[model samples]
Target: MLRELASILGLFRQPPQDASGGDRTLVAQLVGLLVEVRAAARSNKDFTTADRIRDRLSQLGIVLEDRPNGTDWSWD
Candidate 1:
């Protein structure tokens, strides 16, 4: 999953790790930011940006599931 995350976001100089050896907090925060941006783009009727975010995430094995209330995600 970290490999997949790296593929999607190569922003980290090195991926941060925690005691458990996976930085779940950082991952969630970063991905949550993307999700928020995507949602904002959708709300603004910017389908292109929203679709691009979704497609990129999908390519990285992340599945963004849209719901009436909000969006949910999981590793594919």
Candidate 2:
């Protein structure tokens, strides 16, 4: 599950060779998709999957904030 999620989130993507980095818009979209998946897992009472998702993101330096409106994330 972890591997699948990581792959889907492009965690294995190669680092950009240029200083400009990669596409910010695409990165945001990918992160948003993962966040939605995490929300669905939580709503389904699948805390293990939710936690795994959060942990994996954290390992990538993405900090997640659970707000009343929704979950927000930022680079750590």
- What's every prediction's RMSD, in angstroms? 5.8, 3.2
Candidate 1, residue 72: CA error in Å?
A: 0.3
Provide the overall lDDT of each model, using Cα atoms, as 2-decimal numbers: 0.74, 0.78
Residue-level lDDT of model 2, residues 26-70, one tens digit each, is 666777988999999999999999998999988767789999999
| Model 1 regions more than 4 Å off | 1-22
True-structure lDDT of candidate 2: 0.78
Tens digits of per-residue lDDT, candidate 1, 1-76, equal: 4346656765344433421335566666777888998999999999999998898877755689999999998766
Deviation of model 1 at 10, angstroms: 3.5
| Ten residues in sequence with the least summed lDDT for candidate 2 | 12-21
